[model samples]
Target: MSSQKMRTAQIVEYNKPYQLCERPTPVCGDNDLLIQVHAAGFCHSDLQVLHGQFPAHLPLTPSHEPAGKIVQIGAQVQGSWKVGDRVGVLNFKNSCKSCVGCRQQLRRRHRTDPRFCQSREMAGFKHDGAFAQYMLADPDTTVHLPEKVSFEQGAPLMCAGATVWGALQKLKPDVQPGEAVAIVGIGGLGQLGVQFAKAMNFRTVAIDNRDEGRKLSMEVSEKLKPDLVVDSSAPDASDKILEFTSGEGLAGIVVCTDSIQANAWSLEQLGNGGVMVPVGLPKEKWQFDSSALVFRELVIKGVYVAGTEDVQEMLKVVAEHDITSHITMLEFDDIPGIVEKYTDKAMKGRLVVKIA
Candidate 1:
């Protein structure tokens, strides 16, 4: 395969469609793996990169959620990884291991924070990503895919799944079992959040807006089985949530939509001492009531994608619980169409490209 050339979807300019072109397969570095991508999940963030909404280095390949089999291993790479090993690539390609966050993660054996590392490199944004037949990955940032998880299921876990998993973790040690937790937005992340909340023994309430959103929420409930579903478009959305929980209000709310209105409304539904985790990146600035936050002692926290350990734990949860992402599969050549759909807000769940 030394002389092999692979097809890639390259973003040659901002606000432009990806150009499908052939390029030489990337060479494996000493601590890297050459992955033959089987599936790559399209994200709303990728659309942000394309539309110049997100800061990114130009001429980038924009699919961060990728899963595939290792085709080549670097000489220095070790520990169970070999040719044919199934794996999912993480967004953080590499991080400076000497930073405070890195030192904490290394010493604690869990990720406290590594996003502050000055040397962090992000796939699909700062470097080339898996929107192609083959992509390069650092072994340290890649997780082995369990046999029970299909490539399509494993792909979105790299970003969407791991993201919500990390966000849900923020509620830990505070949110007790049987406490009602609300997941706002029934799209890709919210759907996964509902499953994670249920798996962790939390009473899950799924919230969405409008008739279309209500229909999508119903579909998700049928598949994932949340405890309750709330349509924020209703006149008494907050009232219904409080009534459902017997006036206890939600213990925590995970805001998965990029709509500012949804985020604001979710904050109002939180009970005293409740936490609101905003996982979505809305282009507009958020405007919520400060007095409500102060009087109720509500907490609003932001989370990026998962750390290395979080990614591993997320994968284990998915495998152990038999969780699967609701994804629409398309061919590699259908990237243009998928991007259009995302821009047009037509995507329901997740979209995964069959690269292999």
Candidate 2:
């Protein structure tokens, strides 16, 4: 409400640097909440959007993971959402209520269907997103930020945390408490996956080729650290994982990296009747051995960013278990620098930009 104009970082063209410029503040719609963005997370998806891998409207603001205070509430919003409330928003929005996915979501038959509705608009991809000072959020896909979690952490939790949370959920009915679970590629998402698996009472194994990732998995928190960390590049990595599981192999594996090799290898570490949930998107087509899959009765499922209910539970677990993201905080102006950093080497943890 302070100004009609707002500062934004936009992808003016594919494969080019962002353009920092001014745009009119977004108008809050009947079913939308206007957020005064305080903190926004920089994710690999942003890079994908920039490179045209994830097609987007050109000259669009970009950042899907955003956490901030509500400036205005829409009249049609059904919840107790109001001004001054802290919140984090999932990227998918504008669901057509008449669609099959939306109908299932309304009946609670499927919790994750609304986001998959064909008519939905994806923030930072198909629509203007949170890279601006203010953005519109759909109430159906938004969650409250706990007081214990800061805006910086809450921002990344909207995407990275929700993603791993959904992947782990796929293991239910197959993997149980005290069973071994491996979190592959311990970077932004895998590190959190390990912690979440531990919090869920599974014996967790953190797998990564990088020294920083392995170190970060152990350093997350005392209550949520992985029980074991393995070097994925080692020749005996699968042997070590099986050994950790008392020679039975892992009951579940969460693939958090987009590396084709890592995903293929992770499938080999699963025990009989084990579940493998992949949350990462690789450019190349994924191939698996049919004989192994059929003989072992392995189950492979794909999960996207979590639903609103799942995200709420993840935040509760994060707050209760003291799980935190080791973040590199930057200002809004450092958007280009963050993009450059994500290209070559992986950062220790997630990247967050303080916008306000």
Candidate 3:
């Protein structure tokens, strides 16, 4: 509490190493909670922010998934939130209440969908995020971490976990219990998708390319016990998936990789009337056969980070099922190295920075 300055990892330029420096402690606003960060998870989106692929302002503190204890609370923040509470912050900091998405949320008695709102202020993009020792978060965008969940586990849930949870929820309409669902890419997000698919009573199929990814997918398959694991590196990977499902094909496919080829190939595995949810951000545009979609009656949808309600529900599901993230913890000074590893596709699973 006596510290007047805090350490922050900031992006001074595009595709550059984060500059760790000392800055004045952030001031808490009327509706903000001053958090002392315990753990901040490294997300693929963070890499996008660093490479300037995503829309981010310069000289930004880049990290959206954070879990910590509330050191100070704003006077205007009501409800049961208070100092000393363990909490996780979401990427969407705040949304304009007058927007159509916000009004829809109000009518449904749910949290706002900031991604759809035009006046949304996102953490690590529009505002300073949790890559610092001390950062401010809007109380409405914060979720309480249960006693059963550790800070390391809670941190990645903000973005990575919540994203797949939201995507699975969106695909629920097309997916039926006992039917197979394919999760492309076995990295941070795909792993979570595998767990959620199994927990939701769907027979999960994990798909990844050859080499290290295949090995990682096999390991995850053994640990999580998915119904089937498919290596898309094979020429007949889609045929293998169809064979696994007994020619019914997958009820829905969730594409979690940024590879344009993987995204395009995943569509071939979807059954008639099946939906394909693309969650990863690929730099280049994807090309697919238009006749295939028209004849198969396929549905293609894009999903962003979750709304607050989805995060809350996802937390409950995670706790109930005892779902945990595969994370590698690193010290604060290792931020630069971690970014480099992520860019090179050398890092496995999610990486969490131990800030406190």
RMSD list, candidates in order: 2.1, 1.6, 2.1
Runs of candidate 3 exceeding 4 Å displacement: 1-3, 55-57, 100-111, 218-223
RMSD in angstroms, candidate 2? 1.6
Clashes found in each candidate (C-alpha, N, C closer than 3 A) = 0, 0, 0
Can you write out model 3's per-residue Cα lDDT over 40-61, one digit (the tens) per residue? 9999888878878766667889
Q: Per-candidate TM vs. native?
A: 0.93, 0.96, 0.93
Model 3: pairs clashing at backbone N, Cα or C within 3 Å: none
Instruction: Compare candidates 1 and 2 on lDDT and give the better one.
Output: 2
TM-score of structure candidate 2 = 0.96
Worst 10 residues of 2 by lDDT: 105-114
> Which candidate has the highest lDDT of all?
2
- Global lDDT of each candidate: 0.84, 0.88, 0.84
TM-score of 3: 0.93
lDDT of 1 by residue, 116-208 (tens): 566778788767898988988888788999999999989999999988999999987778888999989888888788888888889889888
Question: Over the stretch 91-184, how does candidate 2's per-residue lDDT look in tens digits?
Answer: 9987887787777776786443558787998998878888889999988888999999999989989999999999999899889999999999
